[model samples]
Target: MKWAGEPLRPQDAPALVSKGLMLADSAPRGVVYLSVPLDDWPEPADDTAQALLLQRAVDGSPVVTPQTVETLVTALDRASDPALVLGPGADTEQGFQAAIALAERARLPVWVAPSAPRCPFPTRHRCHQGLLPTDAGSLAKILARYDTVVCFGAPVFRYHAPSTEDFFQPGTAVYAVTDDPDEAARAPFGRMFVGDASDALVRVSDAVTASDRPWPAPLTIAEADTSGPHFTAEAILDAVDRGTRDDDTVFSLEWTSAEMFRDRLTITRARSLFYSAAGGLGWGLPAAIGLKLGRPDRPVVCLLGDGSPHYTIAGLWTAARHKVPVTFVVCTNGKYRALEEFAEALDVPKGEYLHIPDLGILDIARGYGLEVHRAETLADLTEYLKKGPDAKGPRLVEILQR
Candidate 1:
């Protein structure tokens, strides 16, 4: 009341809270701060305002210009090869369905944008390609293959490392359809259309004729051979893939070699695979615990690199306390492998600091009161993980990758 410069009116509380919620949920997502006096905490809100707020939350995308829509349609019609890049926005039910329909109709190769936390398009679909690289130059090269790139519900692109090169190659025509104008503004190159991604995709699908070209051959992801005794990231992931039922399981991956084998993993469904687009370490373990809490019936597995697990090792304590059914597979490569991989790119020396001391990760997991297993061999890792899908509580498997 003091903030609004009005007397404390109990009736105003519902509308105030609803307004704050609406602001926070609006396009180009951000936080909205609302101050409510303690005295007003228990007061009832106005019924009319509460209803209005609820209606606003369901507010659809703003009206789109027909000319902009026609421009996009014309561009796509002229393109010899056009691809769709579905971003975080496409993760929505409507947007996801529209994207898939458009891709299938156009016989387009669809790639998930880097910023997406969940896979929007069905990974099992023939048109669904794997994620685009986060490297600017690498992504540009991939996009270059398409005469026109139609990015939907996501930013133009996302990059982990800074690069001087432009986001798209010189000849490739780039277009983006998004609800967020900020996303369009931030894009380095593209003709951005401000509209609902799902609406845009649906309209484009209706306008465009089917391509004369045949559907691209589906990628053949070979199964990693875990016959060797030694445990490696690929082998561990392969075993995990083999042992777990894809539909009933969710994988939360950190920046690890297991992430490198994403294409080979059996995570075909949308939202089943989770990872940080920001490239932060230690989120995988804690995220797995959270996912387990959300989907109690599904098995949640965290594939963490040796270095990332340390970022949130304490998460295991919380998982144990709640008896959250999460299987943590720590890929122990004995060093900060990402740093080593980036040494040349970052122009840094590979030093002792990057090497983790023998901290006994199993002991750490045990200390957190988790059911722990140490797998020194591939067979041991596979055997332990075979029971992971049926596990009822927090379990940590330390994989020694030499």
Candidate 2:
């Protein structure tokens, strides 16, 4: 075997690194924090210190801050209030708390401008309005009506001054708060405020009075289990919708669920969820495994595309080896639906060679000793998914898209 430093071939100096992971005692090239900011994250320069009162903005507290909480109390003491838009680039967790507090205090509607991910919430504080977007135009429309964007985790505005067509109604104030200086610096739309997101929220609570902007009501899905090729996607989604239990966690789409599954499945998200606004919730199979690992008692479901599952097929083996209980409900359309959509947009017929690998995911899952079920009809699919917990182990339910 080749020694650690030894070159594989002749005439070469000893290699300093192998496969990117460095040897012990080697300085870390960089640190990647999952969600929480790193303790060792480099301090900002003196010039950047103007944002924070202290010479150093060290605590990196994003979620809740004392100042924001105080602000919230003050706001609660009031009656009418301002419409709140938790803009991008703030400490999301603290911002979420602050938003919720403000909403409760005002006894009015509160909304997370762009997402529905459930994290950093006290288990009791899971109820809040997630914004609605039917299309690009709708997203812009909502952003337009608000006078101010109270950005916490995300930046205030994504404006292309080149075009006001997308801008929210002429001129709107965008204010931002976050623990991270980078977020404050990079916030494109609003005046940046630096502090714990919760603190910033508290500050907003202190400053603004309540407004009459109606908080979006909790999503009420009109469920229909219809049949036909025109309705297969909806039917399958209806089954997923009906089968979903509050105890079940869904990894909402990093995949291209929008192409086929979007209109069909009504996601009732309030708790135990992770989704992306980049519309990037991939048919997150491995992510589902990780979610299951973190919250083993909860049944994690990954609704993936045929293409997305291939990216992390190895994770299935890991699930089997560890006996991680997850149900991978693959929405198989036999073809790449996104690509097909593009084809239609370009007025191009799907090429004859637009073929997918013959991955019998059911057989593959069974090979790994997972309980695999394939449903041809809605009733069977619904029954299998609803009763998955009793299926003994990791389950993979395959439903044809027609």
Candidate 3:
């Protein structure tokens, strides 16, 4: 907890709770603790303090100063090649639109930061370069080409595997705008600006002049080979894309084939995609259920790996009990593909533990009161997804991988 306090008497209760709420709503939001004695609950409340608590407003985000905006505008205009990297915080409604405007006006290539939890920029936009590599060496190599790098809402970097290489070139100028002062202070290198990401982007976009530079080439996806009996990741994602409308569908991804999913699916709006930046297991199922509950007008589909469902299998019961219309597509590869990737990166020896065999995922879902289907072919997967969202209750689709 960032802040903690205890109420010694009943009169202190309102002030403690008010302080906790303010701290929780502040930037880099987090939990706050309030300890109340058991005896205090029986005492009469302070009427004035309770009235003030009810009238309190949420704390506002840190503001972006005019000078900070001017500095960023000048930096972007002076640099020959500058780029924008966005993180989950930039996925807010205002930040999403502001990022697009800033990138367009400044003629900068945009990349989603590694381990981003939300879709900060439209994937199909011409300026989008794709997701940055998580490792230091690869991430540095990509940013090395640019003279300036501006990170919005993201840390300097987030890495899954250990690397000995430096994060950036010596001469490359790096600037970061984030509301979290802790993240700003912890950055290895950058000129930091602590403020609301949306406000900063808007101010910078307004002050910067439009550039005549040409846009970057759009990312291309290789054609899926569906001639085989089993389905490829590409083929499965392609079927999902063909089966759902982009505006009405939201994707909750925790699968191993993230890069392939990015290539196949096009997310053009904020909150259309969700992932966990913490890289924790069991986030996909519950997150999808929550997304469906919050956005009843939009259909939610969660894509998971074979082993991911086991992490939060109970989420299926929650969806079933609520009759939430969520479609869970499990790609049964019979192994933890992500762990294999990490092992390869770290040069660890392969072991039997990596293989997940004979997991009755569909049976588990069925036991939780969810409708289940096994897709034997590309056609079967497409037909199932097309109708899955319209169901009154939750459903699961099991697709065997090649």
Positional deviation of 16 in candidate 1, in angstroms? 6.5
Q: What is the C-alpha lDDT of each candidate?
A: 0.76, 0.54, 0.85
User: Which runs in model 3 stand beyond 4 Å of their true positions?
Assistant: 1-17, 30-48, 259-261
Question: How would the candidate models be sorted by lDDT, starting from the highest?
Answer: 3, 1, 2
For model 2, residues 1-402, the per-residue Cα lDDT tens digits are: 111343233212212222222323221112222222343235343344233433332222335456554444443344233345443332244445555666554544344444433332322233334443433345566656554444554444433113325434555555555555664677545566565555566566555555444554543435564764433665666777567644444544544534323434433432345544344424377778888788776667777767777766878888888888788888776777666765775678898555575778888888877878877677777777777565445788887764
Q: Which window of ten consecutive residues has the lowest lDDT sum in model 1?
A: 1-10
Candidate 2 off by > 4 Å: 1-82, 86-98, 107-138, 157-164, 198-225, 229-234, 248-252, 259-271, 276-283, 342-358, 390-392
**Which candidate should be chosen as best, given lDDT against the real structure?**
3
* RMSD list, candidates in order: 4.4, 10.0, 2.4
For residue 210, model 2's alpha carbon misses the true position, in angstroms, by: 6.4
Give the poorly placed runs of model 1, Cα more than 4 Å off.
1-20, 29-60, 63-69, 162-164, 222-230, 376-383
Better of 1 and 2 by lDDT: 1
Q: 21, model 3: CA deviation in Å?
A: 3.3
| lDDT tens digits, residue span 263-377, model 1 | 6567555567787866778878888988988988787888887788888889989999998978888877678777777886878878898888687888998998989998777
Instruction: Give the TM-score comparing model 1 with the true structure, all chains together.
Output: 0.83
